[model samples]
Target: MCRLFALTSKDPVSPMEAIKALDVMKEGHDGSGVGLLLRDLGGPFEEMKDAPILSGIFSEEGIRKLDLFMMDQGFMTKYKMSIKVPKQTLEGTPKRGLYLLRAYEYPDSWNVDTLDEKELATRLMMTRLKIREMGEEKKDMIVFSFWPDTIMLKELGDPMQIARHLGLDRKDLKARTIMAQGRQNTNYAINLYACHPFFIKGYSTMTNGENTAFIPIRDFLSSRDFPGYMGYQSDSEVFAHILHYTMSGLDLGLDAYKHVITPLQDRDIENHPDATFLKHLKKSCRQLIIDGPNCVIGTLPDNTLFMAQDRKKLRPGVVGGRPGMFAFSSEVCGLDAVIPDRDKSKDIQPMHLDTAIVGPDRQEVKICRQTEPLTLPL
Candidate 1:
């Protein structure tokens, strides 16, 4: 098991808020690693939302190589900010190099391709793929995310220790939206890439349970011509990819997320008010179905946050907080740590049939459930 915590608010807050919350659930995680994502960025990143931030780590030699590579690829750095830790001691992971967070103006073509955003996103994914693959043998550099309006950090350590290492003290690292995960390694080795709270161009997800449907999901994604779908260090990573595939790849609305991940039974579908469409979804994209004892918390490109539970409802999740802030958690204790005095009546623990959505500004909160069957013309 792992601990997943995310908080989105109208105002900027330090990463410590998430760190402190995760610390409360340390029993569920082994302090193996930490992945931090900040969006609706405040502090230094506040004014630079238009530029794509390229965040990852590098070695001394790797830095030079990275400069050459980006220059060759038509990337020019617009602004840069980074934190480098020396002699890190955290769990069983060994320290190898320096980490950085830098923002760049998108390659001119991509920046101007506003009409074809997915094509641009695919370019970004392919670039990230090159960095991860080519940098492997030399272990020169690793880039995590390259997107406008957000920054990501991942490292092997206790969440608190990693927080300190990040210098979260000043508002420099503040953001209105922050997500964190305390690692509980159940799959691949505790490599940085395998860490929870995975991110793609604009989509991100962190899970607390294993995805039993991994192989089929991987196969479906791999068959796509895109380069981002090949890596599967964590089965839950596919959750984010699947989210990307469902929403961006197919231009489907958010409701399709449920149809693809956890569909209704034949009887349940026949009985559903939206049966016709649901049945069409089941028949057309059956490859996306997820077999789970899994519960997921994630964000889409628009920063619309959501939470979902599998059919078995095996993993625990609770969503509750004050008006300006909504917290998504894997347990009630995590929510209590975020908004301890939250109204008990307003607390939401979505069942298998429900998906909880909180808007970008906390303006509204609603539970999206399966629609009732409707009578329609044949």
Candidate 2:
């Protein structure tokens, strides 16, 4: 099994806090790998908010090839940050090429004003696919997350050890939101793509349990003809893609996620207060449902956060925080590690029927409890 931790703050906080929380639950994961995703970034990235940040690791040769590809695409790097994570700093970690975070402007003809969010997002995904395929061919370069407001870093080692290696232990690489997973390899080879906190466009997710429904969900997503939906090295990646599909493709509301993944029984829906729409929603998206023992913590476009547990609630999870901030984690101890001083009286371990949503607005935490039209803020 793996462990998951996510921290959403009204202000910038380091990824170290979330990684350290994973350390608190060290026994729960084997720690063969670690995946970190930071969005709603602060620090230097905040200044480059309009630029798309391309994040990946590349060997010297791969970097040379990558530069050529970017130039061919008519993209120009406005600024680049080369992260030199020395091998010596990571005692037991596997060595790889330097990790890079570079911001780029759109192709010469395609100005930012003319390209909408989806267009730029599509371009980033296609570029990422090129990088991923290149890496697959020779095994040196792998691109992780590429969107307007996020950066992803993944590695094979203990979370603490990886953080120490990157010197994140001593620095605050700030982001308003951050997620880290202590990955326990279950199905595929220990490939980097198999790590949690998977992203496509602006949506991202990290899971703490197995996805028994992966095959059907993957098939459904791939059928969408969206390039980003094609890759599924990790079953949990579907969780992120599905969220994107629900939000961008179907134009469904946030509550649609719970409905699609763990829809209510027809009988319950028939009796639901909003039966007309509830019935239509379940019938329309039945193919996207998930069967599990899985719990997922994720974010949508606007720094909106959510946590969902399967109908069985097989994996543990909790949501708690004070005003203007919140945490949705696989365990409560993680919340304690991050928001120890927050009001404990409001802590919630949502039942299987609940979907804990933190925002379209970040002022309060909202829980959609079992199809009741009412939403109560915690």
Q: Which predicted model would earn the best lDDT?
A: 2
* Model 1 quality (TM-score): 0.94
Error of 2 at 324 (Å): 2.8
Root-mean-square deviation per candidate: 2.7, 2.6
**What local distance difference test score does each model get?**
0.81, 0.82
Q: What tens digits encode model 1's per-residue C-alpha lDDT throughout 1-378?
A: 888899988898888888888999998888988898888888878898877787788888888888888888888988888676656555555665777778877766555556477677777778878878878997778778878888888888788887786576666878888889998888777687888788877989888888877888888899987677767888889889888887777777676787779888899888777777888978877777878788888888777888988888988888998889899987788888877887868888998988898878786567888663322321
Model 1's lDDT to the true fold? 0.81
Residue pairs in clash, model 2: none
Tens-digit lDDT string for candidate 2 (181-260) = 99898888787888888988888988878887888788878788888887688888898988888878877776777777
Model 2 misplacement above 4 A: 89-92, 170-172, 373-378
